[model samples]
Target: MGGYGDVQMIDENGLRMDGRKPGDVRPITIETGVVPVADGSCRMVWGTNEAIVAVYGPMEAHPRKIQRQDRAVIDVAYNMAPFSTTDRIRPGFNRRSREISKVTKDALESVVLLELYPRSKIRVSIEIISAEAGTRCVGLTAASVALADAGIPMTDMVVSVASGKVNDVVVCDLNKEEDNYGEADLPMGVLPNTGELVFLQMDGDLSPEEFKQAWDYNVDAAMQVHKLMVEALKGGANS
Candidate 1:
């Protein structure tokens, strides 16, 4: 939390600085097939954060060591462009990106039917063009849509969302300012159909009650986002 002593993020009416209710999420827009060269692709904009995801393969897993006999492997790379942040991020892999990539791969692997494509590899590339916090959630969610756009068989789509405590109040879909000053954060990836979780991460501090509030907020927000995901996927063949 950054200098929360004097700054006020919530007004007397309980409205946030952005004029949203505590549980409200930021505006979200999604488009599919943004990358024509890739087997499947999607672009998602959530609040000020924007992410593009491309899915390639289920092609032969190169190097015999990487291939699994019973199921395909999910390879994910999460990267932020140099201009994605206020200060130019240096090019190339970094520790933060590596951790995000691993967790994202784990999340997707849970939903993608790897057993269907034996001895193959599915590559999911997540690129962040603009970031305003919650980029990981945006990347993972967009990747799921991109995979579906590629006609990949999956039991369910993953919907990711985050909720955090700002000014001692639990809020959903935190913006950049809130995130920097927030006391705690909990990000979750939900299976919209079954209410099951494939991803979960948290940091900072919160009481048990506050934790429950954040968890509930993320689950509810996921359902709302899931509707948009379904709509985008059904609108056209490319999506």
Candidate 2:
């Protein structure tokens, strides 16, 4: 949460500076099979954030000790290109990346039928080619699609969406500026088919009423994103 509310991001019509309504998400596009060598791959662009995710191997898990006898382990490595953001993040693991990766791996593991591939490793690579505000959400969403593209069995795909408070009003999908100055941010990973949640994170503060509104907004946005994920997979199957 940015926590500064002096800036006026909302206009007289209750529209954001980017002309989006409080409940409207930014434009998004999803595509599959972007990486030829990977077992599964997906490229997703949301607003100005772009994430390319690749899934590889239910291969033999190395270093016998880490191998699970009952279920496959998911290794997620999330990275941002140096040019992905204005700050030029270093091209290696950082605290933020590690945290996001662990959470993402946990969320995906909940939906994927890991028991089917015991003593194997499924690796998910998330590369942030560009970032606006919701790169974490984009990465998680794209990773789920990549996993599906690899023909992994899963109960449902995860749809990651975030809602934030800005100018004392709750809004769905914070843009760069809004995120920098917003009051609160709540990101959730939802299983659209079952309406179940696998990941949840929150920052800043929200009133009970405001929190409920944000949760509703995230669920609604997830449904909308799930539609796109399905279409992208179908398109890939045809192609």
Candidate 3:
């Protein structure tokens, strides 16, 4: 969250500068099974953010410590491509990417029937080819679709989104400017069918009312995103 805060991102009409009605997310597009070499894969674009995810295995799990005797483990690697931002991010592991990967892995593990594939591993790789903020949410959501495309059994898919405050007004799916100049940020991974949360994070400041608004936006956005994910999987089957 940005504390510099000099930008006005809301208008007198209670609409965001991007014309969203405080609860509306930007357009999203999703496509699954995009990488032929991988077991399953998906690509998603939300606003200007784009992410691609690939899934592999239920194969033998490596690294003795990471293996579970009773359940399969999920190995997630979330990375931002060199050209993902206006200023390139040097490739390789970093603390931020590591943390995001860990959290995303945790979220997916919650829904995946890990016990069914003992001594195996499910690998998820998320690559951010373009970013306009909220890359983590996009990555997590895309990973779920890729896993499903791989025919992995799971309780439900995960839908992710972020909401925040700008100019004291809450908004859904904050864009680059909104995120850089915003006052708060809340991102979540939701299971739309069960209305349960698998991931959550927050920073900056939000009043009670503002927090509620942001939460609502994330939930609504998850439902909208879930539809796109399902459509992507269906399209993948036909192709």
User: Which model scores highest in TM-score?
Assistant: 2
Question: For each candidate, C-alpha RMSD in Å?
Answer: 1.7, 1.6, 1.7
Give the runs in model 1 whose Cα sits over 4 Å from its true position.
Answer: 1-3, 236-239
Q: Look at candidate 3 and tell me the lDDT of residue 7.
A: 73
lDDT of predicted model 3: 0.91
Can you give the TM-score per candidate against the true fold? 0.97, 0.97, 0.96
Can you write out model 1's per-residue Cα lDDT over 202-232, one digit (the tens) per residue? 9988899999999999999999998899888
Looking at candidate 2, what is the lDDT of residue 91?
A: 74
Task: Look at candidate 3 and give me any clashing residue pairs.
Answer: none
lDDT of 2 by residue, 205-234 (tens): 899999999999999999999998999999
C-alpha positional error of residue 53 in candidate 3 after TM-score superposition, expressed in Å: 0.3
Which runs of model 3 end up more than 4 angstroms from their true locations? 236-239
* TM-score, structure 2 vs. true: 0.97
Residue 52 in candidate 1, Cα distance off native in Å: 0.5
